[model samples]
Target chain A: MIHWPVPEPEIPAGTHPALAAVARAAVAAFRDARGRFDRTQLAEKVDMGADGTPTTRLDQLVDTAVAETVDAHRVNLISEEIGVIDNGSAVTLVVDPVDGTSNAVAGVPFSAFAGVVAVDGEAVESLTTWLDTGRSWHAKAGETLPYRTTGRRELDGAAVSLLRPHPKSEDAWLRVSRRAGRVRVLSSSCLEAALVAEGSLDAFADPGSDTHRIMDIAAAAVLLPAAGGALIDAYGRPVEIDPDLSRRWSGIAAATPDLAEELAEEINRPSS
Target chain B: MIHWPVPEPEIPAGTHPALAAVARAAVAAFRDARGRFDRTQLAEKVDMGADGTPTTRLDQLVDTAVAETVDAHRVNLISEEIGVIDNGSAVTLVVDPVDGTSNAVAGVPFSAFAGVVAVDGEAVESLTTWLDTGRSWHAKAGETLPYRTTGRRELDGAAVSLLRPHPKSEDAWLRVSRRAGRVRVLSSSCLEAALVAEGSLDAFADPGSDTHRIMDIAAAAVLLPAAGGALIDAYGRPVEIDPDLSRRWSGIAAATPDLAEELAEEINRPSS
Candidate 1:
């Protein structure tokens, strides 16, 4: 037998107590439910989510675990499966109980549990736990010792992750694929964005499509900017995470503001 | 500290002892060198490999470890780095010391140490060790219990992994991407093929370019077939792995022969 260190949850000081509690609850719930998750039950569709995606049995199990945790706290909750729960609290907790659902179901080992706390539509604190590996990335908005992004600026030798292209955006996807030195499709937006923030990946590009929801980008929005990177919409504008589940944005999470702008132009440029 | 079961090295009883020893050496060599590999040395191109790719410093370190092990055996060897060595033996061991070199250097955790022992131009035994996790996949020809591919036939819902598309085949890559339910660029052909063998992924398609050499496909050629899947050339022809580093093939590894043929047609179909 080989001994591996169990990760101790460390909630940074100055984070909202409620937010820290939610994050802890999320990590514990996922760890408990993951062991009991039956692979045979993965394909069973439990319900249609507010986001129009089918909620599998695995999604329901994890969603309920996280929802119950957030419900205990007096805060508004916005999630993929259960559109929104108005708790009549000042802060809103945005959560994707299980990001990369397909990967989880298929045992790809690249999914995550993600959550973010927002105050009056501005993200203040966030946490992302890699479900397969117990490592977590957390950030508070105004912390001095923030995480940092790599100083890589060019695409020629840069490693970038892109969302799988929709049929309409094939040309744009191809152009980006050709230009970037290396391209990957990890299928987890928040985790990939966290990787960009930590300098493992140079950037993550989402083609201008209605693919990403608030729950998907909330944690990343806080983590990236805090890490010296920026996650912006296709027009190089700041992305706002409202309580609405229907709002979708196309954007890039890059190591630098300059790289984000450069990628936005490259992706949005017309093909000659 | 939590106790995790260490994977016991299990070489099938009927397998050739020499091939099994090589597999063990490859795994141990990778695990030892991986910990000491520095990221700063990743970009130092020490030499141009016989396979035409620039051999990075990390590659040389692991390659040397693997080569020394193979040299002790009375068998010919073919590899990406030092070309071929003839030992006046009937067996030819094909090895890719570090598949997915970029991913290893960048901390992507999806690279592998892949090897295959061939007898008279036919892959007789194969091994692929995932360097990130200590899990391994091995197969011997004529074994009753081979690995299996998923039963997915249609492309509409298939999860396919492609080698990053080159500029000339951007249109073909787009066609595959649009038709498949999910498309991933994992960069490691051997690991991706292992995923296909174990049914984690439905298929792994290598675009018809000179991107893949014998060392890259040797293990997949053995394991995929044993698992009730077919790894064929883009023209739906059987791939032949010889002691040549210069031969390249465009291929698709599907869960079934029918699916392989379908993908070949889809990729080779005229781009209108």
Candidate 2:
């Protein structure tokens, strides 16, 4: 065993009970929907969305269902399909009713993550969410109680899970894939990247065209950095989580700053 | 939901208790050792094998432990680290103590498979084994029941999982990854191929080098074909499994014969 020294970082304290509650409810909703969706008997009861994404009648129903239930708590909603719903409050709630629409439609068991990012104009804090498996990973802005794994701490030893391989960047794919101790392309990029924040994985890379929205990585943005990990744009720059819900960005997330830097440097290396 | 009209094919039988028994014991030992190895407080407690592969003291202990347990059943053993051990019978047991050694050492969850292709010198009879999570998949020759999947019935919309991007293969990766409704690379070729057999995934491909051995795909050979899938080499040729455990090969497994043909043609495309 090639042992490496790792500093166990702490989870922050801003993870509110309200955020955790919403995250749990979101996960349960997704899990229940997933089981029903996978049953051979009920494969086609859903409808298609405007973006050409699969949105089942169940999906819309679940979206509205989550919206209504969370609205009861009077938290402002920033969602994937639907944009933001402001209730004249400082704390904004961001949600992806179903993050991995494609996978969820196809019966892959991943996660439905919901995050609450308390923002006062430009400053942000905290994220908490649960997955379909009833397992939750959360971290406050500066606390010490969340995901941590024991292993060699090289970004190379990390499982860099991607949604799809880089098409225009074959050389980049080879570099990342070779360095990644193991590469997994789990369909759900949202959950895949969140695993990095939870320390279940060392890093997560998207590096696709800038089509991945903030809603896709918003909860992850809040969750990862709070856990001592960082999410950076494809250019290896920090991703600014503006109030804009539709702002799309391509990037990577690392469990540690050192890993984020290492991966960024390697992935950003000039393709020979 | 792009539903295609098709009748389900006859499911093949893959019931082989003795082979299944050996596989089960080996997988269980590896998994238990793996779990302990993951939590081992000391780093050097693990053993690195001569093949540049990882073997924990737990792995060695488990391999021996599993072999001795199988010895009680009076079957010969052929494993990765240790060469073939005779048991005074014509029967030989082919085993890969751990299929994805790199993945295992890195704590990546993938299957550790075993195959017992009962052969009388040159004639083959049956095979069976367990996957990463301990799910049993197997089949016997001339048996009608092979582990099969329902998803592969819809060829047009079926999901195909690959181990890595096609390596030097023409449009094989592109055609498959884009054509399939969903594509994933879970890193474990054996388990991914096994899942194809079990119908969890519609198809699987590992276009890597010939590092994948007969032992790696032996259990899959029994499981996939019995489950209505086809396994072939990277060149898309038939993968012949010899009774001797010394051989290794590279290949792909598809849920349907049509898919296998499609993949082969695509990979052989001149521009690809």
lDDT by residue (A110-139, candidate 1, tens digit) is: 778788888877788898877766567888
lDDT string for model 1 (B152-267, tens) is 77777788999888876777787887888888888899989888888778899886664778788888888888888878888555577765677888767788877888888888
lDDT of 2 by residue, A1-272 (tens): 00111111122344554465566555555555555444343235455543345555445655665676567777776666545667776766666666665545544444356565666643254443424333345555555544553322477556677657545655566677777766777766566666666545677776444556666666666666666777677764445555565466766777776776777677678888
Cα-based TM-score, every candidate: 0.89, 0.78
Candidate that would win on TM-score: 1
Model 1 lDDT, residue A82, Cα: 81
Q: State candidate 1's TM-score.
A: 0.89
Quote the true-contact fraction of every model: 0.71, 0.37
Point out the worst 10-residue segment of candidate 1 chain A by lDDT.
A1-10
TM-score of chain B of 1: 0.90
Proportion of true inter-chain contacts also present in candidate 2: 0.37
Candidate 1 Cα errors over 4 Å, as ranges: A1-40, A73-75, A88-91, A119-121, A144-147, B1-37, B144-147
